[model samples]
Target: MSLLFCEVISAQQSLPKIHKDEVDFVNPLIGTAITGFAKGLDGGGTMPCVNVPFAMTNFVAQTGESKMGRMCYQYEDKAVIGLLATHQPTVWMGDYGYVSIMPQTGSLRVLPKERRLTYDHKDEIAKPYYYSVKLKADAKTSIKAEIAGANTCGMFRFTFPAAEKAHLIIQGINLNPELTDWANDYKSRLKRLKGYVHIDTVNNEITGYNPDRQSAQLGPELKNFKGYFIIKFDKQIRKYGTWDNKIIKKGSEEQFGTRMGAFISFKTLANTQIKVAVATSFISLDQARSNLKKEIPDWDFEKIVKDTRNNWQQQLKVAQVNGVTNEQKTIFYTALFHTLLFPRQFSEYGRYYSAFDDKIHNGESYNDYSLWDTFRALHPLLILTQPERINGMVKSLLQMYQEGGWMPMWPNPTYTNIMISTHADAVVADAYVKGFRGYSTKLAYDAMHKDAFEAPDGDMQKKWGDRDLWTSYEARGGLTYYHKLGFVPVDKVRESVSRTIEYGIDDYCVAQVAKSLGKTEDYNELMKWSANYKNVYNPATGFMAPKNVNGQWSAKPDSGFTEGTKWTYTFGAMQDIPGMISLMGGEKPFADKLKHNFNDGHYRADNEPGHHYIYLFNYCGMPWKAQELVRQHTGWQNFRNAPIGINGNDDCGQTSAWYIFSTMGFYPVTPASGLYSIGAPQFPYIALNLQNGNKLVIKAIDLSAQNKYVKEVRFDGQLIKNHIISHEQISHGGTLEFKMTSVPQKD
Candidate 1:
């Protein structure tokens, strides 16, 4: 046997078994603290979301208020108003189709502010599936609230102190009122917000539907969309009533125009615990009731919480790490938890409603595709760990294309053309080349081809028109300019350089799929256009500057980058790193520029564009530098079980996905390349259980904080001569061993 094999076997046997429940390591409150950063821009703008993996409904406690308050659960808030059924992707985009539930005593205050109760952080507990908080209304009355849920149904258990008047108020309001108003102004349309609530006193149940008036923020297609929900309680109602616009009405049910809700008041003894089950649907109230019956029929709160925890545990067991500090495990598992929270399941049972088509369909559907952000890492991570889920995602995307005409960029249960480019092309093409066959490849290719070549007109044009709020670069944002001028013009587009570079990457991904599918002509055509990023390269400035239609460079070259500087976008050509390096006159210049980016504070780890910049050193033949930078970024900018752990918005789990890939000792620099750039591994041992019944085990010898650099790397008893590994090698399952040392390996 080889000496390396013997050493690996000995190490594997010596390591402790990972019997600690993975769910215990996940701290949902790690990123929920409110920092001074911009509302959506805050890196810690995450909620203690309690739900099943990718479940359509998330149960979270609301703390603070903001113009864009999607992440309403802030750690620093002195009090929590209510627990809400939220479909919020992030604070930047805002939430939709949500209702609030608050438990109050002593008096019946309908407004949120009057009913808000103070809470201490020490009295709160948060996990992937369960969350609990102690609410103190006054010196005399206190309430203990806990929440847990399945796919579409949530269970809320509240323990109240003995009181004369104990009430549970259920209200529906616009979560993002300011953003909706802003959208109304931009679209020049004021759609009335409609809400309805019907109460059944005999059954002790309340059912309603709230139609969120579409705003320019969500595009025109989603205007006046509605979502229905059914709420049932276990405790008997001593008295039942309703309220409209804070006006007290002694009745069983009431429906109001814009601001309306229903409440139930009952007398309870001390330590009386009441449980409520809430089920929601995009289809109708009856479907909501059916979902509730199918998902959570009984009031077994403890069983539901246990089952939810076990579900998260099973999902998290896909990758098991050992020999790391407790802090590192917390960060690792928390990131893994965040990565699974988005692109949620939109279908309920066997039925779904598509806001894109304004019709009901009979099948499973997925929504919240933050493709512009997730195509980089989140989707690729799923392709490696959860290929079956990726298959479902691809099938869902293709179905949306069939119904809506164009593939989605971002969809909050509907197509919301919010971000920069059509990167769904990259996601579909990546999944296809990676051999995920849940959908029709021919249909996917046809859809991508049409999106790439054709222009929008008629209804399609109207849908694409809302995307022109920021830039009028083209009807579909720079497709015309990219075809005609080889690059998008800064004078015409809002974020010209960012769109051009991203489109080039997307084209490269499409070309890969075309080549694999035997479309020689299409492959050659897309490959030529993939080099269009070269046209925007500014030789003298050492940056990817934007150019006008006249081929003149923008005098203010940095003006075209999105949410970042010129230096940030300069290193964004992940599809062609060698080409990018050669444009800057070779390896030494490229390495120097990268170092300067970090030294001069040009590299922003808080955003999407600069995520892969640290790993670029491996392509420059200096993996040691990449190792140093990874440690620096992970230690300094990332989390350590604190509220401000994440340095940027979760962005539908893209930021956390970066942390997961980096800590696992590699990252997918190019989404479609099937290649991972090796970096420093945070854990000494990692076992990733692939869906194909294979296990990829990664072990680091003598790994510690100081010994972060890799001295030697071997795969399956053979030495890896380079600093790159392929997805096929990892997915097929084998042992990858890394020898660690404090000193750098100059050779």
Candidate 2:
């Protein structure tokens, strides 16, 4: 190694570090650039608003147009309109809510169908705690924003020359799962808002005039809006228009021009700001105030913004990386930021309404359960860094069982009836194995058993398990087809591979949970379920190849893995890699084959399968190989712009989080599993301040291009020969020393 490399490695041996809270590393624009097979920008609905992750008052409207891409927004004819509380599945999948306060200017009207407003993408600005956009108009009006926890506040400082009329309009445009007719008693639902609002004075006032504003029924044309929530304003800072007195929910006869601010009359020295605050579950006005007070307790907007950014920075610090290019850092960390954005905690002030029971309860509430997507990687990352939150999440899930009457695989408040497999079983199992507390293993195991014994919807598919559980229509038609024939049919193709992998992962979680609970019989039974992977793996092709009912592999090579080929699923042996090694014949061949797979670019580093597998080498006695792979991968995966820069779908942040962990020289490959498999370190040194008030210090000795492999290893202060580190050791928090060398240590 060169002198500089020696210097870096030497420094690594004696490096100092600090906790995540000490760092200032919040950057929300990381994965904002859209890339991969998915379309649309990499924009995200998550904001560095407040608290830890879910404590923000409200997230701004990520996009107003609905173009059906990563961040696509749908617009009516021309009007820039309302916010849905739901934003879709990141920038990859088209699903999400736009919550509270839609602002528009000029001729306000229902936006035309999915006509994405053309804005200068260059003018868009997103920061750790703020966002700004210049709308696509004749004279693009500029909009800037900040948020408290659940309430979003914006400053649309419009600039205008002498104009016939300059207008500002506020209208509630449409809702997803679109509403039909305005219930006369709609106020009952609207009245749910009552929370504390901490402001300078008591008068960060809300004016609810125009209650009877005229509605324009646009037929079944619009997706969901019984009647529009239209409010007209005539503040001294800007011109205002009267609410149209026409109530028509049938067709689009309303003129678009008259809808935007009636007209605009400009004054030269003109500037003004509007504060829009909205709460979703408006039970009473007091609840709204409480929500506001909890989120924004002070008048210092800048302080709140700074605090929010600082929150993101703290989480970003949990795992740090170096040596990669700046763009790589931006993309990796930004994507990490997005992964934690949603399933936001809708509960306010330690109390939240449970969708399961339809009753108000108390606890640290969290939502936006992207269980289907996040179960793969995001939750696993959380287990390593934010394990404390695991208990509360478990409790909340238990509460879901109490209220909703079953363990939810893809749980939200109202419904738990979606997705293919029981992955929460995996999440809970992973948590238990990692040694999380607060809830009982027995209870959790019971919930898991209930879920699996029951059908997809938590009801026993047969007479209380007297017979085999009837798989849900989707599962039966899809999974059973695979079980019978070994290959998924073509018609049920959208999520074929995902379904297969998920089934295996979920069953493995079930087995793990059972084992953890000491229910050996159940564990043995579930272990068989874990063997579900065999149903799909086609050894003839040396891949997790698809098969049909009669046990014939798909003639096509790309049948089993989702969004990837057989090369990816070849590593789907997450549940039992030792068995996989045995099947592959031995550690040497398995290691060699894996190196070849990744070297031939068989590894989908940007995809979900691309995650957590490098560390598999450690289990096979090839830690050096795992380290080299990690070092090589982190060195090259650099995309710095918005969505366009990231590899594959951000999957929230799992993909990037994988890179982050791998570069740090270790990863929690299997969720809820306490062991962190070591990988190669890119940084000279890194550290993590464990929640238990200790530190995880990793020093790469003699680490460099020429000295990347470990010649020796030590734990605490004792020398060791293997790569695996126990959860107990990590939790106790001490130095982990890796003495590096060019060649593997002498056996």
Candidate 3:
């Protein structure tokens, strides 16, 4: 009685039939083995999630931190704790309001370390909509679990072996079950669980709430933040129990402690199946039940899988690529699938629980914005490919502004202040500049203005480093210094070099919003401030070195950079690249400095800061260098059809978005700017089903391994110059063709 795994989203190893669906090309396993750092082969911190696009929740298999440092699941893990209902946006981020379930055939073990089951990679299937695995519960017994889901509800169907009696263990907390103090310090243990669970035998149901947000360690703690879950079983519960601190209560119905959970057993026949429908909500238990009733009112498991797959198919059909290899197609769709996973829907049904205000609000909401990383490419890509989400995303930002008093730099569903800058300004301005005004432009401008101008409560009291933790809200740290001195002093804030560069970019974005709103005074002011990055440039040293409070440059060239060397932020002043070129002496010196990073191994594809550096070559006269680098990065060299596909944190799809744009022969080097810096197209022919009901077709004639450089480019039969295209020109939908040749064309 083996369940059939759907071939439409199956691995690319073998095709049982001719599958023409674009979802068929997606292989979620490609990025599951990601590591936490950029130097590793698998640093893209992506999970093989099963959920609808931009879902409120996704289902994944948990590795219990016994494997990868902080990831829930890695492709190479020999065993998994259980299937988890999680809101973890990426590998580096903490998973909040999560729970796990595992089916067993023997005596119940409450601890994840005790009940872990071994499984082979061959026995697993992961897709955007569904995931299934066969686990060896013991050497003598085995169980199969199939998971499918809607936006917030997930259904797990388990097939059990007949003789041993079926049992389901529910993990309601995020504590390390193997902690040594559970025996000696029960009270301390209870305080740590931060979760509660209840069992109702008569109704065959379980309900609980977990309010723990692990990321709050480095940010403001929200007292009202909680994740509620409602679970219903199709099969009757013959027996039930709860566990805490190694003590098992065979009939207890509820528990309110850490490392605590409940288990239920059912009488079953050989090869009998049991279905558990679980619903989650940040609002309340009632809302969780409501979501469950709306999404999974029936016991049929395959119905959920079918509906979700159809949803993904329709979602992916927005972009189609022809004349590419199956491997390339798999990588492309997998990257596409990754891009749609984040800026998750924070609203449940019609209501949302705001961590910012600590209140329930009736409005649209979206969060888990990795703004520092995403504002570069992910948000820009969504501005085009996922136009439907643009307004809602902007509205969500405005909502955060109204509730939290400002837009979050990194909203871990709330303001974590994890990353730097106010790049939400870029997200808002990019959407508006793309002609999407569904949200209030005035409100967006205010938020951007607040981000740009308003200093945090204590802007000068202390250096606000990356992990300084909830010191009011470090919106534009050292902003006061920037206003007075043009460049932030390293003594005033950490990572001053990058801060100046990023703040300058955000200034450009805010200025764009201001210009659109006819705020000429603010626009002129911001446009001037946008060039503030020039102050950090040490012309004698040829690096954007940090400046001390005394206005002396750092002796070390690589000092004061964020997550990279000084070379990383040297050319990061994208708002004024032409000025940056002149500052670097000329295009040749600027190009040479850019080339030095690539040649000397300072350019990082594993991180977001330099992801745009290759495209910057297009800004100079020698786009030929950019074209070849595009092929090298987008092809088998970096993005591959393997577990280590992406070499960096997908950063909620920023890494993947880079692939999509680079392979499509364009990129948004500057966010608020409507232009896409041109690069070489990977595919011979590509088509984007734009949001404006038109198709933008790109053709790369004579494209092959031998012909990797673009000889010339054209738009609507007009020869393109300076290697750029505007949104107004491309969004209306016309052919942008490229003539490819083995040798670089001087023109």
- Pick by TM-score: which candidate is best? 3
Candidate 3 regions with alpha-carbon error over 4 angstroms: 1-17, 35-42, 66-69, 177-193
What total of clashing residue pairs does each candidate reach? 2, 97, 3
Candidate 2: tens digits of C-alpha lDDT, residues 1-747: 333344344554434465333223345544444434344323232322223454323444445433223243311123334333333434322322222344443443333232223455465555545655555544534433333332322222233333343333333222222222331122322332111111111242322211111111100011221111111122332332323223322212122211121221233322344444343332234554555455555445556567666776777677656443334345556656665665555555667756455567777666546565566567766766777777877776767767667655443333423444666777777777777877876788877786554433322222111112123222222544444444344333434554555666666677776776677987776666556666665555556665543455557657544556767777775777787787777888888878888888677666666576788888787777776677666653433344344555556565666666766677776655567776666656667767767778888876676877777778888876567777778778888888877886535
Alpha-carbon lDDT, every model: 0.79, 0.51, 0.83
Report RMSD (Å) for each prediction in the order shown: 4.4, 8.1, 4.7
- TM-score of each candidate structure, all chains considered together: 0.93, 0.75, 0.95
For residue 622, model 2's alpha carbon misses the true position, in angstroms, by: 3.6
Compared to the true structure, candidate 1 yields what TM-score?
Answer: 0.93
Question: Model 1: per-residue lDDT, tens digit, 507-533?
Answer: 888889888989999989888888888
Best by lDDT: 3
The Cα error of candidate 2 at residue 202, in Å, is 14
In the predicted model 3, the residue pairs found to clash are 35-42, 44-648, 193-258
